[model samples]
Target: MKNIQRLEMETKGIALSQQELIIYLQENGLQPHEEYNAQSPSAKKAIYQTALSTLESVANNPEMMRNVKMDDMTVSEFHENLTDRIDQLEKKIRGMRTDANQSDFFMLFN
Candidate 1:
């Protein structure tokens, strides 16, 4: 078995098979290693690879991005959005209450 220990070690000890690496690349909108003419052993190439991997990890984590984006919002903006959602929910609750009251009245009459 061709264990990719070097690649795994480079990626903070996250061991991934060749197939898994290919899938990861695809999921992260990255081209395969074969597509890049990256055969040379250069420091620049290594740095680029590391940055790209970091980007992939960040992109794949939706919750992290959501938190980061939420953090970027101003307090006022966050409050406004929350208020809008709450208003909508309150409207729904009011409508449901009216509906339930009508059903109860109809049941008592029947």
Candidate 2:
């Protein structure tokens, strides 16, 4: 649906068709809320989750991360970049969770 495309745009370099998104959600045991907008923190979390998963797929594979030069980039550098992106996404997701789950705590002193 429109929401999926919006999510794709929000996610840098990510492009997943509706079917692909559904499959990913199913495969990863992820289910976005019934009414999630592209700008919602939850939606951003889901997008980051998807992007993280995509990167981890290649990052986890030594062969995929093997000697593959892109102009001036080295294989080690590429792997490091992917690792950094995955780490960043993880941190973002954690922050989103913290924000979304915030609650008030009160204490009284007599």
Candidate 3:
């Protein structure tokens, strides 16, 4: 048996997103099941299962294991990425609100 640490919804103050899982699966060379949409329930399940299998390999699994030489994401880098994503989301929300307000204003004229 292999010791596989299951990833939680939020790990170390960072919320895990579906995109991250898909990336991990791809990095590990697992071909995600394509029958369903990328965000579909069946696709997610298939990706998760493949990842779990890769993590289970006891021997030196270069594909699944993190390579220090290639992987360079530090805490600071993660924080910066998170901040950028939040900023983008905030901008999008603001745009949506402005659009909604404009729509309402136009409705009043008609």
Candidate 2 local accuracy as lDDT? 0.61
**Clashes in model 1: which pairs?**
none
For 1-110, candidate 1 gives per-residue lDDT tens digits of 11123334434423345676665544434445533323333322332344345445544555544554454685456445544544554454334432124444445464
Q: Which candidate is the best by lDDT?
A: 2
User: Each prediction's TM-score against the native?
Assistant: 0.28, 0.61, 0.29
Candidate 2, backbone clash total: 0
Candidate 1 segments whose C-alpha is farther than 4 A from its true place: 1-41, 70-110
Residues 1-110, candidate 2, lDDT per residue (tens digit)?
44445445544443345676655554544553344455566655666677667677667677756645578889888888878888888888766742355555434775
Q: List RMSD in Å for every model shown.
A: 20.9, 5.2, 14.2
Q: After superposing candidate 3, which stretches have Cα over 4 Å from the reference? A: 1-70, 97-110
Q: Is candidate 2 or candidate 3 better by lDDT?
A: 2
Question: How are the candidates ranked when ordered by lDDT, highest leading?
Answer: 2, 1, 3
Lowest-sum lDDT 10-residue window in model 2: 27-36
TM-score of 2: 0.61
